[model samples]
Target: MKKQLHLLRQLVQQAVTHSDNTTSIVTDSFAVNQAGDLLMIKDVMIDYLQNLSFSKKPEVFIKRKILHTQRECITLLDMLPRTKMATPDQVALADQMRKCLDELLRHLHQHNCYFSCEVNAPYIEIQRITDKTFQKMTVMKAALKRKKIYSELLNIICAAFDRFHLSQQHTYQHLQYMSALQLSILKLCEKASDLDFDYQLIEHLTYWCFNECHFVDYCKSLIKKALKPHYGTKQCYEQLCHFEKRLTVQQEKANLRYSVQRNSVKYQLMVFVQAELECIEKKQQYHSGGKGVTLKHTAQIGSYRVQTSFSVAALAYFMKLLCESGIIQAEPRSQLLAFIAHHFQTPRIGEQELSASSLATKYKQVTPRTAHAMKAKLKELCQRIDDDFGSGD
Candidate 1:
């Protein structure tokens, strides 16, 4: 009987949508559709409609019902502070049920399950004759996107983990707890990335925890038991703590990496700056007899000697800074400077009409030389780098 009745509602809806000029005679049809399954289908359709509506209003009654049911389950399991009545299985089952119910409630709240309002417009838009039509420019409206309550989310996740901790009392509950904590941390990072939160401490915390685990006490102890032998020895694992870093590593590592990168770029600038000076020297030699390579001087020799001189000088200075000072090791700094010099040490541009500033600007960086009057700017920069960072040597 219910199925037959359901068909009547669908049939009536189809007729109404197709109705055209039969407004009067079709009145009886509309009346039949309205009365057919009003009790059964009205709320069902409204429930589906709620999914499409986005509102900020909270549904207190529905939330209360879910909370009430969840609390009842928890109570039945005796998961209270004073009660040891809950068995391991009961605690786990109750916690899972509560989490599921709470998730549904959150979904409903996000959809703004119940809200209605009325607005009355008093004026009919009037079109005027013999008048100008004004065009309004486009405008932008700012809106706050719904933000996750991370603290609340974290608490719920911890609650679930507490149940996990209670249920098994396994050695690896510590490991699982760490997993839960890590997931919470990742969610925090995601929220910050999405502009829903502004947390600036993650980077600093990452450095503080560079070689340490975030979890301690019971959780860490549990994990220590779990990872006793089957995997990576506790020393090699370098987990990142930042919720916002585009690069990985402790904060100090990131800072040093940035410094090294800047220096490499500066060195490249120095290389090209030297090349410009060389071309100038060549032009002067061409104007005089010394500029052109004579029968005695080969172009290859001129190129190799000048390039090797600059390369050795730059590399030696860079290595000296790293080795002699406590700043860095000689090997790493030498390798880095060599890599940069290898990429940038191209033949000098012949005396084209382009000025040094224009060439540097075209490359999107300011040169230390043309932007200044110093004839030995490259040498000065290398010397400064050494003086500032150089140690005993």
Candidate 2:
């Protein structure tokens, strides 16, 4: 029973890692299917162990080892705190671990009922035929075996704890780096007011900021995966306490606000570029003595207006409509609208191109009637914008 339990636990660990890998990418669905299959297999193993018999003397020793292992598992459950943000798959794995522990304990209790009074008198006499010294030595050997079994179990659980701890640290560092890059780009956006700012630098920063957000999302995924199991260990718990102390709830909220500020940074940089172009166009018009020049279309996103001549105004207006329609309920609705508009309406280089289908996969979906209403609203807005601007020609 001890060996079977250890082997089963190892299988579960591997399957969990596999599932995490499968769901990491947005382009694939096969991995998700395979992951589901793997989880089902783990469930079968749990059921098998729950029903396995453990009534004889040697089997009783195995039962004691299982009980000790279950205790250790219970300690691990604290790793997955209710407050932590975990992915759905990670939460399911935690639930599976808890259920397995409970099932083992329940089966052990059932086994106890059979030996409540030891009513087999002939069996008791047969057990006494052995010499007292022999019986003592056999019991001591069983105790040693049980100790060895528990030692192996501890190694497995502790190793898992350490592995996830390192994974969390790595992903956390990546998150910090992404946040820093975002801050630097926003600083550049602010410095554009000086009139001598580097357009090239802003362009590069804009591209980097847009591209690296995907990796930021990937890092978040890794963090959620490791958050639960790593916190089970004393070392990890201490580390988390220190880290959380360093970043209080107020500080986190401040950071989130700062992040939202950075959302407009790219558009603000583009506005600077448009201003430069418009200045050149005005100078050329003055030089040419008042014939005419068709100004390039530029799009605006901030405030409650479309302050540009481009088709991006239509996109921005549609996004406002989407937000007011209650499609996305995130705080700072302006920022959420900007994110959805940027990704859905104007994807930058290296960003995932999202369509309605892909958006449905990630965010909330409306019912058929609401969907039809939203579609009609979008169509009407698009027609009005097109009739007003005539494609910016």
List, residue by residue over 122-157, the lDDT tens digit for candidate 1.
011111100111111011001112233334333433
TM-score of 2: 0.20
lDDT of 1: 0.33
On the 0 to 100 scale, the lDDT of residue 100 in model 2 is 52
**Per-prediction RMSD in angstroms?**
27.4, 28.1
lDDT of each: 0.33, 0.40
**Candidate 1, clashing residue pairs?**
285-291, 286-291
lDDT of 2 at 8: 42
Clashing pairs in 2: none
- Give each model a TM-score: 0.20, 0.20
lDDT of 2: 0.40
On the 0 to 100 scale, the lDDT of residue 52 in model 1 is: 32
TM-score: model 1 vs. ground truth: 0.20
